[model samples]
Target chain A: MNGILLAMILALLIPIYEAWQDEDIWQKMLAFASIATKTSIMILVVSVLRDDWMIGLVGVLILSVGNAALMLLAHIIRRLNEA
Target chain B: MLENLDVVAIAALLPLTACMLVTQVDPYHALIIRGILGAVAALVYALFGAADVALTEALVGTMLSITLYAIAVRSSMSLRLGTLATAAPNLDAAVPSALGQQLFPALRQAIKKHHLRLEVLPYASPQALQFALENKEIHAVCVPAEQLATTQGTDDVAAPYLLNVRIPRLYETLAAALPPELVAVSFSRALRLTSAAPPPPDSQLQNALEG
Candidate 1:
């Protein structure tokens, strides 16, 4: 669980790191999105750390739904490619 | 419809678009389509109530279509689609190191200290930098030590400033709003980088000779 949380935070930083290095349009977009998601994760982490069970539960639920959608999108793309 | 275009931009784009539609459908071809769409879209935005969507759809549609078409072509050519897709932003362990951030402030400081007349453009690249210099828009570039050698005048012109700097993280550049890659190379009315005349004699050396 802690490892998963760490992975999420790292994901946010990678873009910020990339944005700093690259001046390309695509690189910048990736960076902005990274910062936004990182900020969101911080809020979620703080809520969990505070033992606010309600908010933490909501955060988890949202994350799960988002992750599921991403997986679903990947599957759809794969099928599209095959078709 | 029939509004708001320089004859030049239109002329450049028309044949370019027609050629792409008829022949090689590459990413650059999409760029021509995008410019055409953007111009058309801007007109539609001005004409009707849906200005924002019109603006977005015009630009987005052109760019996305170009990208999608390009991707499809690449796929047909057996190139992987994974390269086309951008990953979602994730912020798991971003500590925000200052190394990446300092390049901008260091540039600003150089400009300020030198009293240089330079303005970094939006979306400027090294090639653009060389072109601007070639056209005499600006005189000098304050870039990384590595970039100095790439200047057009290494054979004739002597670059006086090759500033090495470490800067602080000034903003959340993750937004890409900052023109970080855009470094200005400037010159006074006096120190032209591409001057046809021979360089002025060194002031200290001249004074010593006279003395």
Candidate 2:
């Protein structure tokens, strides 16, 4: 279980590096989306590994709500470009 | 201790994302990185058996704060430029007028380097435009040299358009970036309280006031 979690953490680093290096706003936003989703999934995996329902529920909430925030941010950025 | 390697790795990501957020130069980019930081923070909190803290971090710290900050940065980081209505008839149109063709693109390009948006507002007369600048309603005013009485009979007459910027930093940016042959950029400290009455254009003043 720990090995799987470590692998997921390694997967997460790919987007973090992308976000840090990319100069384009859209690319950074894509990286943000990747990070947001990956972190919530990691949370879920950890919750399951420990058999903690409370942590699992929080992970589910973040997974759903984080995307909504991402959508709102994307709309704002699109509108910004239009003007 | 080796069994806890995953926890150490996950916890380390929190500081990494925070550093990324702080190092970002652009406000919009920083806001995106802030969202990334919030995500990593929530993950770290959940890993440490603080589910409630994780949820709060995700909901308020990540979602609500980033949305609000994005809106704030978008609206505040723009330069509001007042121009004569007659000079830029098709400013908002797909194909701008000849004057706008010369001005807007160059202005936009210059300010874009600083990550600031250009918002062009039209006024019926130069007085109203100047009034708007003095009132802090706009950051700068761009008018034809012939239209402004104060600019007439000066060396600036060689230039067709005169751009009066109230902020020194904006003046420096425009003066440095814009071609002098295109426009004359000057800085004015007109924001000071003045006893002189505004040029009597009651209707235009009303429009400026409302806008």
Candidate 3:
């Protein structure tokens, strides 16, 4: 279980590095989406490991709602490029 | 000690992401990084047996705050430039005048360096254009000197076009970026004073140029 969690952490670093190094706004947004999803999944996994229903519920809510913020941001940025 | 190594590693990521957020130069990019930071923070809070904090961080910190901030930054970090309807025709139309062709691109390039977007608005007459500038409806006004000279019955206008900028910082940026040969850029003091004094309709451009 610890190894699985550690590997997931390593995977999370990939997008964080991409977000930092990439200059393009869209690319940074892509990295953000990846990071947001990955972190929420990690939370779910931790909750399962500890058998904590409350943390698991929070993880589910974040997974569903966090991407809504990403969609809103992307729409605004798309309109920005148009004007 | 070794049993909690994974928690220690996850907690360490919090500071690493925070550093990345601070080092960002662009506001838009920084906002995206901020979302990323919030995600990581929620994960950390959940790991520490704080489910409520994690839920709040995800709902309010990551979702609501980032959306609001993005909208605010997009609208505020822009330059509203007013020009004659005849000169621009429409916001997206290709400007036919030689000065428009050269000046617009230069202005876009100059303001782009400061991470500001350029928005062009067309007004029917010079009076309306000047009115917009005085009322603080727009940041700057661009007019053909020939048109103003024809209206005023004087050919003393030296430059091909005139650019009146109301904001001092914007005036400095435009003055530095634009060539004098392309257009005459001047700071307008009408915006600085109280709105009680109405601008004289006919010589508003001249007044803007002089004071």
Candidate 4:
């Protein structure tokens, strides 16, 4: 059975896999950034309204870091897709 | 109160609780619902009063949700052999601990009984415990839940009485704290509870076991 952590790991691996597939520095970076950007918006929406500020803050920080990784990947993927 | 869990634990528990919140939805929707719920929580912080945290959450969550959703959407394409209930790894970990689980509660109870504040330290080896004492993370070397068993005529380690706080049997106290589903039938998680008696010269329960 997939425990919660396993599921979460799988969830995280998606953008990483996509960036690897693109083979271009820029496209991969952008795609990676897009994923992060989308997730951050979601987190910001959530955090703006939570009872616990710290929890909301933690979620936001995690998303931001993830997106930054994707931004690096986004450049690669975009280039590969164009070529 | 969900007192047993620390903040990080609660963060994990909250998303899982979505199973109850969206009983009728498909798993994808359930995930979305959870994300949305988290987002809603963030919004509350932003709008109601905690803008600093709201800003912090806003940036990180945007990235995190991307990762989670990307994975979820991709996983849907595969012909997984089992459903989510059976397919996930490490499901057995859901069964919580039995003995050591009470270590915290027992300590707390002892402190409260004496009208004292509560502080907890990590479990460590004797050397590590010594280090912790030097660092002042712990004032005493706490004992395991097991009784202090001893054989005569050997050198028994004299027990130290730092503070007079007697912890009840592990089986007795945490028994109440756990859900009915998690209690194991035999040889629960407390490592010390079932060990052989320490021969006199080596048994530290001779001195430091009592707090």
- Per DockQ, the best of the predicted structures is 3
Stretches of candidate 4 above 4 Å error? A1-83, B1-25, B80-211
Models, CA RMSD each: 22.6, 7.1, 6.7, 21.0
lDDT of 2 by residue, B1-211 (tens): 6879998999899888888888889999999999999999999999999999999999999999999999999999999988666433564542225446777889999998899999888776556766788889999887655555642334855666678898998899999999888788888855222223333234444776999
Of candidates 3 and 1, the better by DockQ = 3
TM-score, candidate number 4 = 0.21
Candidate 4 residue lDDT tens string, B39-59: 434433543456566555544
Quote model 3's TM-score.
0.86
True contacts kept of each: 0.00, 0.93, 0.93, 0.03
The TM-scores of all predictions, comma-separated, are 0.20, 0.88, 0.86, 0.21
lDDT by residue for model 3 (B1-211), tens = 5888889889999999999999998999999999999999999999999999999998899889999999999989999998765444464452335545788888899899899999988776667766788889999987665444333332335666677799999999989998888778878744221113233323666877899
Model 3: lDDT of residue B8 = 87
* Model 3 chain B weakest 10-residue run by lDDT: B191-200
Q: Rank the candidates by DockQ, best first.
A: 3, 2, 4, 1
Chain B TM-score for the candidates in order = 0.23, 0.83, 0.80, 0.24
True contacts kept of 1: 0.00
Ten-residue region with minimum lDDT total, candidate 2 chain B: B191-200
Check candidate 3 and list the clashing pairs: none
User: In order, how many clashes per candidate?
Assistant: 15, 0, 0, 71
